[model samples]
Target chain A: MFGFCADPDTLGNVAWMACYLTTGKHMAIYLSVGTVLLLLAITAPAALAFGFAGASAARSRILPLSWLGRGYIAVVRGVPDIAFFLFFVIALDQFFEWIRHEVKCPDWDQPIRQGNDFVVCAEAKLPLGNAAQWVHETYGFFLAVLTFAIVFGAFAANVLYGAMRAVPRAQMETAEAYGMSPRQCYWRILVPQMWVYALPGLSNLWMVLIKATPLLFLLGVEDIVYWARELGGAKTARFTDYPHGDWRMWYFLALLVFYLLFTRVSEIVLDRIMKRLTHGQATSGGEAQRKAA
Target chain B: MSCLQTIADYGLRSIGIGERLLPREDFTLCQQFTLIGSGMIWNVYFGLIALLTGFFLATAVALGKASSNPLARKPSEWFIFVFRGSPLFIQFFFAYFAFLSLKSVSPIFDPFTSAWLGAAIVLFLNTAAYSGEIFYGALLSIPKGDTEAADAYGFSGLTKFRKITWPTMLRLAWPAYTNEAIFLFHATTLVYFSGFPAWRQKGDALYYANYFADKTFNPFVPYPILAGYFILVTLVIITVFGLVNRRLNRHLPQESRGRLKMRMNLIR
Candidate 1:
């Protein structure tokens, strides 16, 4: 990162620290922060879409759709989500490979599951056996994002379901009186109105999503946690320049602070958004605003 | 081996009792159930102990946050923010590493590096912070008239708290606190997965489940069994908390009593 980092062994303490911080592994750690942010950027809206679908389905008058949606929400409940994280990644991966095997290698005589090993045909591999390393990493990350979206979507559905219910019944009744169909009433009235009600819960879920990014490490992504563990482990003098004792505590401390600040900033922003949403609304917040005015 | 023999061999395996070596291959349904069920002992141990110990600290934290004194208020606020803001996953890692360093500093801190003491401490602090926030909200929402009534009755401090304020807070906070308790128990699965090593293969339910999944390369079986155990634990927690919630709300009329609802507050 700097010219003084040319020879790490000969560098002064501060320069050595700078070089160490700018090393390839450290760069990976920094890049992995971007990975965490990218995951949040992608997962938030994806989960919201899933949540909206789930909430809508759960609210459907149709019996099976409602059952499907309600079951989606209920089953994810009570169970440890880490189990989902662990289970879905493998299960989804296998499901995809199995599908690919069925389509691409119908002639393959070998059973996909032979005892403990799940051996799909070579062409049926997720990224294919011959794919670049980056493709494999991206495939893993994609699986992770999908898993996150699925799990958090269930949570969001619960929130949105409540928020939809919390919308004033009079508004929907008014819509009905105006001859709006059920679908129209839902989109034109309920969807827009539910945001204010959902904001608090959605914001709470956002914080949770932010905190959960660390779990990406468990899913085989070289995420921030992975990097922190990798780079912060004690390095022997024989290994390379800038060897140091265990610094995992410090690295984790940095991560803790990063999360703290991220959540704090998010809370402040969410508070502002909530204030804005409630500005002219008929809820208690609006009532208080009117009184203050 | 017979099912009873399997149970007798692997039932207490999680606490490092009967089995010297985990079954390696040709996994049976019986082995999965027995081993994972045995592992639930650790989960129960972690959750119950952490919840029990964290309860007192949570109350203190809640009071501190609600206190007017900045000296108390600032630390309490920060404590809640730090613990609540960060993932418990990170907390476990940070704590494990911190304990390792502490262990190096003095042999007296040796046991702190182990999951039993170290992870429990992290879970303890983590749950305390969460419950503190819940209790603080309940404190703020405590009806003003209730306190005025207490004042009129010449009650103050500990006497007033024990007689009126505490009960009201617990009653109000019970539903949310129940959700927190459930999630905290769920959060216990992350213990062995984090930096703390599960000594001698004695691990939580998720640990055994992961082992089975790895051994079998079939997540279809063990993960569901693990989830089933957790669901069972969740039901038990709800029943116990529901009983307490009922006791707390006993004075209220049947129609006016607060009902337990499962609000989705996923992850700490």
Candidate 2:
């Protein structure tokens, strides 16, 4: 923020506008975009890891693990994901606190669920009772990211599970014939080949993820959507040096444009990645390229 | 209260018909199931109406996009891109705010600020754009030979489209369109969560589910019940669409008819 923001009322139109935009709240709003991106950066990989575990679990020879994995994927499929987003975050938080309360408060005799309230000892609190503001925010954000990863991990698992199967049965058999262990067959043949198949779904999941970042606001994070509503609401003449009518429409328009551009760029990048993955592969895309060459 | 008594009081609670005040304490499993199930009426209302209306408009949009005239093509194309490109969550907020802004200029737009009309309109447009693209893709893939055969005959323009192109487009787009319908149902859950406040707590299934989650601080019960209801609805949708799909492909030979396999592709 430029320091010339002292007398917003006395300043000219362009100067006043500049100063108004440089307000502390506006700066926080600007940084919220970074928060959105940071979430995407962290959640994408986390979700991928969860998906990999899930896919691997589903494919496991062991019965319970496969059932767990398949159930994870199938159950998540039927419900609205927004329901899961709202449900899992609270459920997980409570489950964690209940565990912590049990560990820390063995002597306490009071029931944890007293009527409508979920009460716990002070130490059982997620970030501790006297934690810093940043810690609470971080904890909430962490829960949100976890929720996103879990919901989307199911989707990604669906994609990856299919992609894993899409790798021909022949390829795995050939790996076994060549004296490779099942693990070797998986790692060497299936894993590498699954990428091209997974790319389309993964890329789609990425777009859905990017679009879903707005839902962080629902989870009580000060995400871009939250800030847009906060900053864009009408400021009374008594409230600030700068008075503005309701500008939520404009704020939301900016968000729409931001998402549009993000998805457009992602599409271009994913298209390029697809081309590279398809090169010399047996798919029709690769066949066309081979014919052209 | 007995379970039957509780159901009697709260059965139509979601539509503002019964139980003016929601149950605050001593929640029963039966009460949870009854109220949430009642709330599903709104979900069905929003989804069915949106899909029903969007289906007709989507065909127009698909035809518009396929038209050689840029005048007709551009708007439909842009409509598809904007709606299909953005998240439905943001679209809901943006639409609600946009409707609010329009209210002062004309009283005609007043009802749009309400959740029922406004949210339904957004869902309608969203599904339209999604199904439009699906229809457009199907239009593009319509075999040239069929069109040529029509051309070779006296069939042209309206007659050509009515007799030949329309059936083919519907047949091709049916599978993707079915997925879009399911996705729309999933999307109706976001309506209450977005900027639109549920008028007097007359809300969708997820709204009531969220209410129970808040009250009891136990998510395990209400959410799963809601999911069960949704899965039941989804199964019904699949069956209904499968029948329609069969009808669409009825003219084709048995071997050539398309199989109605369900794929959970997120449409629009």
Candidate 3:
């Protein structure tokens, strides 16, 4: 990244450190932070949408739809979400490949599950066998995103459902008296008013989502945790230019500091958001706002 | 082999007692159920011990946070902040590496280096912080009237705390505490994934599930079985906590008493 980074091995002290920090692997580490942020940006709204759908379905008038929604919420609530994360990535991958296999290989006679291997046709492989290296990485990242959305979506659903219920019954009655339709009341009154209640839970969820980004490494994405482990391991002279003893402790410490900083910033932002959401509202924060104003 | 035989062979497999090698090929429903069910022993072990131990520490931390002195208040506040601020996954890795380094420095601490001690300590501290926050919230929300009534009756210090404060705190915090307990159980799945290495292939449910997934290259069987086992464990936790919640509220009149509603808010 700098002109002085030409010879990392020959340079001494500050120069060596400068070159080492700008190595290609370090660039990947920097990029992985972007990956974590991108994941948060994408998954937040996606999970919110999923949660909205879930909350709505749970409140549906139809018995089966309501049951289906309630069941979805209940099941996810009961199990450890990491189990779902581990389950869904592989299950979804196989489900996709199996679908593709049926479509792409009509003449193939061998069973897809032969003994231990999931032998999908070559064309049916996710990202395909011939895809670029980036495709594979991106595919894994996408799966991680999906897994995150699904797990956190259930949590968001629980929060949003509670928030939706917390919307004053009298307000709904007033909307009815005004001759507004159920849908209009839902969209205009309930949804708008619910944000004040939801904001607290949603902000908490955002912190959790931010913290959860490291689990992307478990999903096979070369995330910050992956990079930390890769870069911080004892590098022998046989393997690389800079040989060092096991520095995983330091790497994890760096990750811990990074997360602590991220969460602290998030706390500040979420507090501001709560204040904004509560402005002139009837909640406790709103009372403070009124007093200040 | 029959289901009974499968159970006998793999029931203690997670503890490294049964089959030398995990079933690799020609997987069956019985095998999936048995092996995953066996793996759940580790999850339950981790959750129960952590929750049991964390409960007391959480109470203390909650009290510390609510203390009049800044000396008590500050450390409790920082403890909650540090643990609650970071992900449990990172906490596990941070803890494992920290323990590993400590083990290198002093071999006498090898017991602490193992997953059982290391992971439990992390979980204990993690859950304590989370539950401490819940208890702190409950403490703040304790009715002023109740405390004044206790003061009016000449109750002071430990007597005031025992008679008026602690019970109310427990009652008020019970619902949120239930959520924390559930999440803590869920967090046990993370133990093997963190920096801690499983000795002799002894690990939690997700670890064994991952093992089968890798071996079979077919995730369908093992993962669901693992999920089912967890779902059962979760149900048991809910039932037990619900019983405790009921007992906590038993003193109040039926109309005034809060029901033990299972709210799935993620505390961890």
**Candidate order by DockQ, highest to lowest?**
1, 3, 2
TM-score of chain B of each: 0.98, 0.96, 0.96
> Could you give the interface RMSD of each candidate, to one decimal?
1.0, 1.7, 1.8
Best by TM-score: 1
Error (Å) of candidate 3 at residue A150 is 1.9
Native contacts retained by candidate 3: 0.72
lDDT-based ranking: 1, 2, 3
Docking class for model 2 is: medium
How high is each candidate's TM-score?
A: 0.98, 0.96, 0.94
Instruction: Please tell me how candidate 1 rates in CAPRI terms.
Output: high
List candidate 3 segments past 4 Å from native: A1-16, A107-110
Give per-residue CA lDDT, model 1, range A16-78, as digits (tens).
Answer: 888899988888899999999999999999999999999999999999999999999998865
Q: Model 3 clash pairs? A: none
CA-lDDT, candidates in order: 0.93, 0.90, 0.86
Candidate 3 chain A minimal-lDDT segment of 10 residues? A1-10
| Candidate 1 lDDT score at position A52 | 92
Clashing pairs for predicted structure model 2, backbone only: none
Q: Which segments of model 2 are wrong by more than 4 Å?
A: B265-268
Which of the numbered candidates is closest to the native, going by highest DockQ? 1
